[model samples]
Target: TYIRHDSKDQFTGLLDKNGVEIYEGDIVKDADSGSYGAVVWSNDKHWGYLFDTRPDYGWSHPVKGFQRNYLEVTGNIHETLLEADNAKT
Candidate 1:
Protein backbone atom coordinates (compact mmCIF):
# COMPACT_ATOMS: atom_id res chain seq x y z
CA THR A 1 0.00 0.00 0.00
CA TYR A 2 1.19 3.47 -0.82
CA ILE A 3 0.73 6.12 1.79
CA ARG A 4 0.78 9.60 0.41
CA HIS A 5 1.66 12.53 2.61
CA ASP A 6 0.08 15.95 2.23
CA SER A 7 1.98 18.14 -0.19
CA LYS A 8 1.56 21.05 2.17
CA ASP A 9 3.51 19.26 4.86
CA GLN A 10 7.02 19.99 3.76
CA PHE A 11 10.08 19.52 5.95
CA THR A 12 11.82 22.72 6.90
CA GLY A 13 15.23 21.02 6.91
CA LEU A 14 15.63 21.90 10.57
CA LEU A 15 15.29 19.93 13.80
CA ASP A 16 13.92 20.91 17.16
CA LYS A 17 15.84 20.91 20.42
CA ASN A 18 14.78 17.32 20.98
CA GLY A 19 15.98 16.27 17.55
CA VAL A 20 12.43 16.23 16.22
CA GLU A 21 12.04 17.22 12.59
CA ILE A 22 10.21 20.55 12.17
CA TYR A 23 7.77 20.56 9.29
CA GLU A 24 5.01 22.79 7.98
CA GLY A 25 1.92 22.67 10.23
CA ASP A 26 3.99 21.39 13.12
CA ILE A 27 3.37 23.40 16.25
CA VAL A 28 6.62 24.40 17.92
CA LYS A 29 7.62 26.11 21.12
CA ASP A 30 10.59 28.29 21.84
CA ALA A 31 12.50 26.82 24.73
CA ASP A 32 13.89 30.15 25.81
CA SER A 33 10.92 32.47 25.17
CA GLY A 34 8.16 29.92 25.84
CA SER A 35 6.34 31.16 22.75
CA TYR A 36 4.52 28.54 20.72
CA GLY A 37 3.50 28.70 17.09
CA ALA A 38 2.92 26.73 13.93
CA VAL A 39 5.59 26.32 11.28
CA VAL A 40 4.51 27.79 7.96
CA TRP A 41 5.89 29.08 4.71
CA SER A 42 5.84 32.82 4.12
CA ASN A 43 4.70 33.46 0.56
CA ASP A 44 4.87 37.23 0.99
CA LYS A 45 7.85 39.47 0.44
CA HIS A 46 9.79 37.59 3.14
CA TRP A 47 9.55 34.36 1.15
CA GLY A 48 10.76 31.80 3.68
CA TYR A 49 9.79 29.66 6.64
CA LEU A 50 8.25 31.38 9.67
CA PHE A 51 6.66 30.64 13.03
CA ASP A 52 3.08 31.81 12.91
CA THR A 53 2.08 32.54 16.50
CA ARG A 54 -1.33 33.84 15.60
CA PRO A 55 -2.73 31.85 12.73
CA ASP A 56 -5.98 33.77 12.79
CA TYR A 57 -4.26 37.16 12.55
CA GLY A 58 -1.18 36.14 10.55
CA TRP A 59 1.41 37.23 13.11
CA SER A 60 4.68 35.41 12.62
CA HIS A 61 8.46 35.53 12.95
CA PRO A 62 11.10 34.34 10.62
CA VAL A 63 12.76 31.03 11.50
CA LYS A 64 16.11 32.54 10.65
CA GLY A 65 15.82 34.85 13.66
CA PHE A 66 16.52 32.06 16.09
CA GLN A 67 18.68 29.00 16.35
CA ARG A 68 17.12 25.68 15.44
CA ASN A 69 18.08 24.30 18.85
CA TYR A 70 15.73 26.79 20.50
CA LEU A 71 12.67 25.28 18.84
CA GLU A 72 10.76 22.31 20.24
CA VAL A 73 8.16 20.46 18.27
CA THR A 74 5.10 20.04 20.45
CA GLY A 75 2.46 18.75 18.03
CA ASN A 76 1.00 19.29 14.59
CA ILE A 77 -2.04 21.33 13.52
CA HIS A 78 -3.63 18.28 11.92
CA GLU A 79 -3.63 16.10 15.08
CA THR A 80 -3.20 18.60 17.90
CA LEU A 81 -6.55 20.33 17.53
CA LEU A 82 -8.35 17.43 19.18
CA GLU A 83 -5.85 17.45 22.01
CA ALA A 84 -6.18 21.20 22.46
CA ASP A 85 -9.98 20.99 22.56
CA ASN A 86 -9.82 18.27 25.17
CA ALA A 87 -7.64 20.46 27.35
CA LYS A 88 -10.11 23.33 27.25
CA THR A 89 -12.69 21.34 29.17
Candidate 2:
Protein backbone atom coordinates (compact mmCIF):
# COMPACT_ATOMS: atom_id res chain seq x y z
CA THR A 1 0.00 0.00 0.00
CA TYR A 2 1.25 3.49 -0.85
CA ILE A 3 0.39 6.65 0.97
CA ARG A 4 0.51 10.03 -0.73
CA HIS A 5 1.38 12.84 1.62
CA ASP A 6 -0.14 16.17 0.93
CA SER A 7 1.80 19.41 1.25
CA LYS A 8 0.74 19.37 4.87
CA ASP A 9 1.97 15.81 5.26
CA GLN A 10 -1.48 14.38 5.39
CA PHE A 11 -2.82 11.25 3.70
CA THR A 12 -3.56 12.25 0.16
CA GLY A 13 -3.75 9.08 -1.86
CA LEU A 14 -5.47 5.81 -0.97
CA LEU A 15 -4.29 3.16 -3.39
CA ASP A 16 -5.66 -0.32 -3.97
CA LYS A 17 -3.95 -3.61 -3.18
CA ASN A 18 -2.69 -3.63 -6.74
CA GLY A 19 -1.12 -0.23 -6.08
CA VAL A 20 -3.88 1.63 -7.90
CA GLU A 21 -4.79 4.89 -6.29
CA ILE A 22 -8.43 4.83 -5.33
CA TYR A 23 -9.15 7.72 -3.03
CA GLU A 24 -6.94 10.75 -3.25
CA GLY A 25 -7.42 13.78 -1.04
CA ASP A 26 -11.14 14.29 -0.50
CA ILE A 27 -12.73 11.47 -2.46
CA VAL A 28 -15.85 13.52 -2.86
CA LYS A 29 -13.85 16.22 -4.59
CA ASP A 30 -10.65 14.77 -5.98
CA ALA A 31 -11.99 12.06 -8.28
CA ASP A 32 -10.41 11.37 -11.65
CA SER A 33 -12.07 12.72 -14.81
CA GLY A 34 -12.21 9.36 -16.59
CA SER A 35 -13.12 5.98 -15.16
CA TYR A 36 -14.60 7.73 -12.19
CA GLY A 37 -15.59 4.35 -10.78
CA ALA A 38 -11.94 3.63 -10.34
CA VAL A 39 -12.20 5.32 -6.94
CA VAL A 40 -14.69 6.05 -4.24
CA TRP A 41 -15.18 7.47 -0.71
CA SER A 42 -17.04 6.97 2.56
CA ASN A 43 -19.91 9.26 3.30
CA ASP A 44 -22.14 8.86 6.31
CA LYS A 45 -19.30 6.52 7.22
CA HIS A 46 -20.40 4.15 4.48
CA TRP A 47 -18.25 3.17 1.56
CA GLY A 48 -19.73 4.55 -1.65
CA TYR A 49 -18.69 3.22 -5.02
CA LEU A 50 -17.41 5.78 -7.47
CA PHE A 51 -19.91 6.23 -10.23
CA ASP A 52 -19.48 9.67 -11.74
CA THR A 53 -19.96 13.30 -11.08
CA ARG A 54 -23.31 13.85 -9.50
CA PRO A 55 -25.16 16.97 -10.51
CA ASP A 56 -27.28 17.04 -7.39
CA TYR A 57 -24.71 16.70 -4.59
CA GLY A 58 -21.53 17.17 -6.56
CA TRP A 59 -20.48 13.59 -5.75
CA SER A 60 -20.78 10.13 -7.26
CA HIS A 61 -22.25 6.89 -5.93
CA PRO A 62 -21.41 3.26 -6.52
CA VAL A 63 -24.23 0.84 -7.10
CA LYS A 64 -24.12 -2.43 -9.04
CA GLY A 65 -20.47 -1.72 -9.75
CA PHE A 66 -18.87 -2.89 -6.55
CA GLN A 67 -18.00 -6.50 -5.84
CA ARG A 68 -15.14 -8.76 -4.90
CA ASN A 69 -13.13 -7.42 -7.77
CA TYR A 70 -13.52 -3.91 -6.47
CA LEU A 71 -12.17 -4.92 -3.08
CA GLU A 72 -9.10 -6.52 -4.59
CA VAL A 73 -8.36 -3.34 -6.51
CA THR A 74 -8.71 -1.13 -3.48
CA GLY A 75 -7.14 -3.11 -0.68
CA ASN A 76 -3.84 -1.31 -0.72
CA ILE A 77 -5.47 2.03 -1.06
CA HIS A 78 -7.56 1.42 2.00
CA GLU A 79 -4.63 0.26 4.12
CA THR A 80 -2.43 3.14 3.03
CA LEU A 81 -5.09 5.70 3.63
CA LEU A 82 -5.60 4.35 7.10
CA GLU A 83 -1.90 4.40 7.82
CA ALA A 84 -1.62 7.96 6.62
CA ASP A 85 -4.49 8.97 8.80
CA ASN A 86 -2.79 7.37 11.77
CA ALA A 87 0.51 9.07 11.02
CA LYS A 88 -1.18 12.44 10.85
CA THR A 89 -2.39 12.05 14.39
Candidate 3:
Protein backbone atom coordinates (compact mmCIF):
# COMPACT_ATOMS: atom_id res chain seq x y z
CA THR A 1 0.00 0.00 0.00
CA TYR A 2 1.11 3.52 -0.75
CA ILE A 3 1.42 6.02 2.06
CA ARG A 4 0.36 9.62 1.63
CA HIS A 5 3.18 12.13 1.51
CA ASP A 6 1.68 14.09 4.36
CA SER A 7 1.62 10.98 6.48
CA LYS A 8 5.38 11.00 6.46
CA ASP A 9 7.29 13.14 8.92
CA GLN A 10 10.37 15.20 8.25
CA PHE A 11 13.68 14.27 9.83
CA THR A 12 15.11 16.86 12.18
CA GLY A 13 18.66 16.05 11.15
CA LEU A 14 19.41 15.11 14.73
CA LEU A 15 19.75 11.91 16.68
CA ASP A 16 18.62 10.66 20.06
CA LYS A 17 20.94 9.47 22.80
CA ASN A 18 20.60 6.00 21.32
CA GLY A 19 21.69 7.26 17.91
CA VAL A 20 18.21 7.04 16.43
CA GLU A 21 17.21 9.79 14.01
CA ILE A 22 14.88 12.32 15.53
CA TYR A 23 11.84 13.15 13.47
CA GLU A 24 8.70 15.21 13.82
CA GLY A 25 5.98 13.36 15.73
CA ASP A 26 8.56 11.46 17.77
CA ILE A 27 8.02 11.31 21.50
CA VAL A 28 11.24 11.98 23.34
CA LYS A 29 12.14 11.82 26.99
CA ASP A 30 14.39 14.20 28.79
CA ALA A 31 16.83 12.13 30.79
CA ASP A 32 17.52 14.94 33.22
CA SER A 33 13.91 15.96 33.77
CA GLY A 34 12.30 12.59 33.09
CA SER A 35 9.53 14.25 31.13
CA TYR A 36 8.16 13.29 27.75
CA GLY A 37 7.12 15.37 24.78
CA ALA A 38 6.49 15.10 21.09
CA VAL A 39 8.71 16.65 18.46
CA VAL A 40 7.11 19.35 16.36
CA TRP A 41 8.13 22.14 14.03
CA SER A 42 7.92 25.61 15.49
CA ASN A 43 6.36 28.46 13.54
CA ASP A 44 7.67 31.21 15.78
CA LYS A 45 10.50 33.56 14.89
CA HIS A 46 13.08 31.00 16.02
CA TRP A 47 11.51 28.68 13.47
CA GLY A 48 12.98 25.28 14.11
CA TYR A 49 12.27 22.00 15.81
CA LEU A 50 10.46 22.21 19.14
CA PHE A 51 10.16 19.69 21.93
CA ASP A 52 6.50 20.19 22.67
CA THR A 53 5.34 19.09 26.12
CA ARG A 54 2.21 21.21 26.06
CA PRO A 55 -0.10 18.26 25.86
CA ASP A 56 1.25 16.79 29.08
CA TYR A 57 3.03 19.57 30.92
CA GLY A 58 2.03 22.91 29.39
CA TRP A 59 5.59 23.80 28.45
CA SER A 60 7.94 23.41 25.51
CA HIS A 61 11.53 23.99 24.50
CA PRO A 62 13.43 24.40 21.29
CA VAL A 63 15.34 21.29 20.27
CA LYS A 64 18.56 23.19 19.81
CA GLY A 65 21.78 23.77 21.68
CA PHE A 66 22.56 21.32 24.49
CA GLN A 67 18.99 20.13 24.91
CA ARG A 68 19.38 17.48 22.20
CA ASN A 69 22.05 15.75 24.21
CA TYR A 70 19.63 14.46 26.83
CA LEU A 71 16.79 13.57 24.51
CA GLU A 72 15.99 9.91 23.94
CA VAL A 73 13.30 8.72 21.56
CA THR A 74 10.94 6.49 23.51
CA GLY A 75 8.24 6.27 20.91
CA ASN A 76 6.34 8.23 18.28
CA ILE A 77 3.12 10.13 18.85
CA HIS A 78 1.06 7.68 16.82
CA GLU A 79 1.99 4.63 18.85
CA THR A 80 2.15 6.51 22.11
CA LEU A 81 -1.33 7.89 21.76
CA LEU A 82 -2.63 4.53 20.70
CA GLU A 83 -1.17 2.93 23.78
CA ALA A 84 -2.70 5.61 25.96
CA ASP A 85 -6.08 5.09 24.38
CA ASN A 86 -5.87 1.39 24.86
CA ALA A 87 -5.00 1.82 28.50
CA LYS A 88 -8.11 3.92 29.03
CA THR A 89 -10.40 1.37 27.44
* Residue pair clashes in candidate 1: none
1-89 per-residue lDDT for model 3 (tens digits)? 11121358777788877778787888778898887877777655331334555556444477775777898887777776777999999
> Could you tell me the lDDT of residue 51 within candidate 3?
51
Each candidate's clash count: 0, 4, 0
Residue-level lDDT tens digits of model 2 in 1-89: 33443453233244333445444332322223323342444564434545444646555454223232333342334455697999999
Locate the minimum summed-lDDT window of 10 residues in model 3: 45-54
lDDT of 1: 0.68
Q: TM-scores of all models?
A: 0.66, 0.29, 0.68
The list of candidate 1 runs beyond 4 A from truth reads 1-8, 44-56, 82-89
Identify the leading candidate in terms of TM-score: 3
Give each model's whole-structure lDDT: 0.68, 0.41, 0.69
Best by lDDT: 3
Rank all candidate structures by their lDDT, best first, as comma-separated numbers. Answer: 3, 1, 2
Q: Model 2: what TM-score?
A: 0.29
* Model 2 residue pairs with clashes: 15-77, 16-76, 16-77, 17-76
